[model samples]
Target: MVDKDATAAVSRSEEGDFVKSTWEVTVTSPEGVRHFPVYRTILKVPPVVLRLVQGELHFESALEVLHRREPVASGVLAVGETLRCGDWELSLHDRSGKSRAVLECFTDPFYSRIWTLHEQVTRVGRPGKRENELEIDHPTMSREHAVLSWEERGPVLRSSGRTWVDGVAAAETVLADGALVQMGDLLFQFRLLSELVLARGGLCVTSLGSFQARVHGELVTEKAWRTQAVRWMLARLALEWGRPVAVERLLDEFWPEMPEDKSRNNFNYTISTLRQVLGGSEAILRATGSLQLSPSFLGSHDLVALQRTLRVEDWGAAVELYGEYLPGCYLDWAVAMRGSLEQQVLQGGLRLLERYEASECWPEVLELGGKLHAIDSTCQRTALGVLRAHLGRGNASEGVRFYERFREHLGVELAMEPSAELAALAEQARGG
Candidate 1:
């Protein structure tokens, strides 16, 4: 029997096979959060089929599962792109305006398959007992219909039978990054790893400062969001970025107090609104029982970009990018990420400040030191660095003034004085 007041939730497990997935079932109540693992065949069970039966979850296989497959690129995907093996017609495009291809069959919309083209030469044709790079079982497809090859220009398609690129019949066409190719009656999207990276005009998430989402460099204002839930939903999705977040987890997080059925409905509604705000369904990538932001659409994210910039020793640019993560977002997940990012920048700034001071780059040192001090006012090293920077720049009076404020701050905040080393630096500033 189940507790009448308890709410049941399902979270995805890290491990799963093609046919079976282990889901962690959490039941939350006044007693506390208790749970168990439930196993379901991925092919047979959809996340929607779980229901409460006599106080426990009854997992029944749906009559027909929309057997979707998302195929990810075999090679390193572009910076903002995440390709998964799944059946989705992601209307992602490169700068040239050609749709980025994720191969899929149009006949069965519910049972579509997506494949990543990784090979130099890929043969496409009708399915047989023999294996081919891509196989279409349609009657219009020949045994060997078309061949795709990576060339100096890009992915080029050559057809032995009737084929079309972007609806026009063609013998050969250089696939524009993401081009829809029709071989006989079967249509497939063709793409290359190189093209996805080079593709331009995608989403840019700026969370390090004010929370802003820009699609193709155009800002998505607060008024654009239909609801606060929809806005936060995008924030959560963008925060996870490349990682696929479980749908069940989202339902629990977003509306734990609401009934399970109501939460699911709301979740679906939120996704619909988010899709509209993001431009299309392709902006959100769907995997098996999970969702992720489309990598192709995510052209630039300040948090991700800032880390990359820091890695390349672009300290100034990194500092410029650093801001409170999701400024007004007080959600638990947002707060946690904000703390981690703040620490990362604080540590990086300290290192850069040391390097600048060693090179006698006082202006850079002062800029970095002030930022680091703001992030961690209690740090004696930062205070000392700031003083030295001012002294180095021949601004002795300013250094003394800053030291006096720092001393007072330490006394009031911690009931302590500046460290001996920091005090000595302050003395030098005072003497000058």
Candidate 2:
């Protein structure tokens, strides 16, 4: 009876606690955008959110986060709206938004984030006592170092002082996707966003596994090509997609064994046939004694995608693009191209394997290692990688089987035994 007030206060404290709930937030950085789960508490801001916005994360800086168009802490979570903090932009969304978000994340770098012309011209350099869009804290940077502006071609970097584009000194240069720009001591990678909607659609040239062309997803058959000369000519042009091919080079490459006059006649006929096959004369551009596949018609090619993936170190995509390299095409030029592509595949695979192993991703290591070994059984590193992945996953029997098969294959194919390191791994798997 005497402590009635104290007892009521304790009871209210226990019953009035706030319930926490989890929500999905999409984080966008310079590298890409990814989603993260965040918790809501009635009493205070979430610690994780605070840390992310405070620039404690390894991959992002505050400028990238705050620069995102979507405001981060808008109280109500809108499905498509973005919220920014330090280096992360948290966009609220449901399950259906995942795929769209990922696609946006991939295409946005080239379409949305960098290309949204209305976002105003931004400056990059040392953050003065005040705020800036792209704050580079290095001493070499001035407070207002450079201005990034949207131009007719794309984004152009106008340097306030010393600046370099792709290692060349330039006061201003139009930027392309994947162009490296250096200002002061800090280096920035420029990604150009797509401006045009591609009304004419694009071409897909399948040169790796087979020779075929798909115009706007409709396959153009070999019969439609009319002749082998036309097919070869199309493949050659497709191989050197954006670059101009000299008429002389085309004659030599397409009909090298034929005489000059006959080759010239064949080249003209093949060009005419190809134009008909492509269904438009504008599909190929001729100017100043050089020919190139038109930018309007040439949209996406497998070889171009493969090279881009490799350049970006997207190893899994690179492996997928490296199908049967120019299979069934016995032309000397095709054979040479095939060899070059195969070498790139092997080298790219090895690099991928190294990265997977470093990250302790045993499953990916096994999968990529098996693929590499299938391509070239003589690859001792790939064989070892597969064996290690099996053992790492606690499948000793599978490791033993893989080693035995690899050893047998090596002996049969190259008349060689397993290397000492690989032999020791086999012994370890066998509990020797």
Candidate 3:
């Protein structure tokens, strides 16, 4: 039996709009016990839970029931309890506890398994049978290996016997997102779900063009770093987001002219001021004698996102991320970083243009080529790409116009004539 009013309340919640909520659950099948993250809407009226496993969704039947004699609100499920709906049953656990987090294992024997960290201390080793939270039965693995526990700052992993982080032998280290953890022959990638959730909707630093930070899609002008010192500091930090930047290195790079003692004091003051501007001291952390911008405070950053898309071979998205890198900033470091990113964008754009040309995707090639030309007006390769894309589409007039503009740009900027290849392309377009 259930309370009709409570049931009606839950029904109303389901009928309303949807909001994102994350959950950790375990599903037992004939193969074994598997754990994963479940993203569900605020309303639980459908009595179904959606599980995301390696970016794929699995629809599993679920039920809403009273837990501890209290009505289970929409999007709210009790921790450490198993509920049955239809033929499927799942045990839910709270992942937002003070010390709770999740570790996703990607090695064989337990690939795609999500390990819930609930206790103050949990161990990772090659346990006999079903003994450990994470078990890897390999010849290279020791019986009792590493320990994972929560610290005030974040989660930390310490090797009890033999373990490695990113191919380096480490006794203890603070776990970072995408860190490769190796024990024996088994390797796993670590991601803090708490950090991921915190990063869902927050400040977004756009560094591809002019540097700016936005909160919830709105520009944060009040906290903008106006001074050169503060602006450079924030730029450097954003460039190395999710990693620590040493104080000595920052001082050497940004303020080498100042004396050591004075520079240190000034750096300290700048850090304090930055924290105040960010609206919280926790946004910047001073740990292990280095500074780290909290990943939780970052929603999206163009540079980081561009690198990710490039890694995945997503040319369209990579092209979209391509823009003027740190425009109008004349600092030496900014100039160097900008040049490096420009080269990367050019190479990526050329690759995409070649692919599109092969597929006869003239419109896409034109779009990408035009963007590349805008970024580097004197780039002959980009000009050729645009001209060819136009010609392929039979837009001879547009191709001639592009060639004329490119020729003019070359003459004005370099005081040189267009290359033979470019001149031939324009001649062919005019003849056509």
Candidate 4:
């Protein structure tokens, strides 16, 4: 039998905590206002509205806009409360009845970590030479957590009228199809294999070689542009993370010889073309801008930034920002990081590897394992790698040490491995 003791009405307001929009709060039940909930979002970039109940708050299902194979549901929301869902925290105020939420997006700490503000907007992609409205106040910036930026209050990001992070518009962004892709921390190339490469193309592939051949041909067939600009664009694509570009760089380096004037516009055209070419690729994020590819993009600066963040006890941000890169990169720095960062880095790095091995981050495995050996000589990379040549399988205790240098090092590995594994490996590595 349905009880007459409960009543719930939903209300929404664009104004956050500024004005409490009270709908008819009719207490018809003998229990008096037994149930009441409110929900809604003022922004439209990623259509989201949440449902709030009298006692508990949860993401209102009707507020979702992005359609995925598996839809991601927003988290629970309560009056004057914060809840983490994916990268954001949903909030509502009871007294003020304010309705607004924020996505606490995570990012790996960089050289300018003290400038959390810079890091926040760094992901927004660079601005053009012309005026950009993206610049805004960062009410979201939290100093206690060492957040850099203010709160990113910009028309470009659109917190009020519109926002991009929560919408299909962000997903609909037309990337160069073949340009490298970066979603959060995972960086890899996107290829057009069979047909599935482009949503419009409808192709998929099993063999990588065929896809590479097809995509490259289509991309290279650029018809209209000054040869220099086209060549420069290719240089940026061909070169990533300071990866080798002898193949294309050579062509671009000698482009002056390629009959020019067939194109119109000089400096302005080149600049505009460059902007269009790079698009949302975040090429400016490179360590620095140079005419040619800077060699420093090579290895593990992301690790450096992360290692420091862990030292400072910024675990939440560390995990959220560079969760994917942590396994391999953390091991190397964990040993060397000291003070608050060491313990935090060691634990978090191991936690990730314990869950994922196919992520196959070997540099850290080698570095941390080596550190262990230097301390006790009984440690092996058994947990991380195949114990194939487990020569140290028996006498783990007394072997000669191998690792020598690190960016920093307080001690070696055996001392660092977690208790259970340390004992087991020691018992086996030594004759215990």
RMSD of each: 20.7, 16.1, 12.8, 18.4
lDDT of candidate 4 over 52-128, digit per residue (tens)? 33334334332332222234546543344433334433344442322121222212222111111112232332233
Superposed by TM-score, candidate 1 places the C-alpha of residue 266 at a distance from the truth, in angstroms, of: 3.0
What order do candidates take by TM-score, descending?
3, 1, 2, 4
- What is the C-alpha lDDT profile of model 3 across 337-389, one tens digit per residue? 88887787778778878878889888988888888877678988878888888
Off by over 4 Å in 4: 1-75, 79-90, 94-272, 275-348, 351-432
| Model 4, C-alpha of 419: deviation from truth (Å) | 15
Shift of residue 250 alpha carbon in model 3, Å? 0.6
Provide the clashing-pair count of each candidate structure. 17, 6, 0, 35
Candidate 1 least-lDDT 10 residues: 13-22
Once fitted onto the true fold, the runs of candidate 2 whose alpha carbons sit more than 4 angstroms away are 1-202
The residue pairs in collision within model 3 are none
The candidates, ranked best first by lDDT, are 3, 1, 2, 4
TM-score of every model? 0.56, 0.56, 0.61, 0.23
Predicted candidate 2 versus true structure: per-residue lDDT over 1-432, tens digit per residue: 011222122112101111111234565667675444321121111112221111111122212233245432323334455556666445554442111011111111121122111234677668787566655556777888887776577667798777877668888888765455556644444432231111323677877777778887789986798888888888888877645678998887777899899998888889998998888887786754777676546555678767655554556667877876667777888889888877788888898898888888999999898788767778999988888888889999989998998899899989999999999999999993
